[model samples]
Target: MTHVVTESCINCKHTDCVEVCPVDAFHEGPNFLVIDPDVCIDCIACVAECPVAAIYVDSDVPASQRQFLALNAELARDWPVIVRKREPLPDAAHWADVTGKIDHLQHP
Candidate 1:
């Protein structure tokens, strides 16, 4: 299974996890990231690297956030691969803990 990037990463957009992905499965978006299930190795390396705990194994995703599994897959197809770490959004700290952020997702 692939890992999913969920609501905690909405505005945060932390790239710490991207740096740890061995297969380069992470994809960048305007203010978030996603994992390409087709390329993800499921190594679980990126999960612990997420500062906001936004990454989760597909089966472990919170019930409320399960949609992220499909969301990641869908967005990964359109977004560019992010193989290096970058500065997070300016207000990352402000939104890292906020929940119910699906509405804030910026689709590519």
Candidate 2:
């Protein structure tokens, strides 16, 4: 029942959600953030903070993006929860400068 990071988040990577996650379920991915489902506790804490509206509850994910739920949980199994997202990764600026990059980068 963990929350999922939808494709909308791919390049829209504003990290506001990371700051609010109680369990630090999120970690930086190459071009996005990944949620560690095992640590997520299904808290739904990160969803509302996302400026791009890219977070989703598993059942609420758009049908086109349903696979992200599995992807989120799978990635979280082996990696540890971040516990603190004190800073955005070095790549944040690139994401900031680009407009509509998220529309182009969504995972299939």
TM-score of each model, in listed order: 0.97, 0.71
Per-model CA lDDT versus the true structure? 0.91, 0.70
TM-score, model 2 to reference: 0.71
Tens digits of lDDT, candidate 1, 34-91:
9999999899999889999998989999899988888999999999999998999999
State the lDDT at 54 in candidate 1: 93
Query: TM-score of predicted model 1?
Result: 0.97
Each prediction's total of clashing residue pairs, residues at least 3 apart in sequence or on different chains, is 0, 0
Question: In candidate 1, which residue pairs get closer than 3 Å at backbone N, Cα or C atoms, i.e. clash?
Answer: none
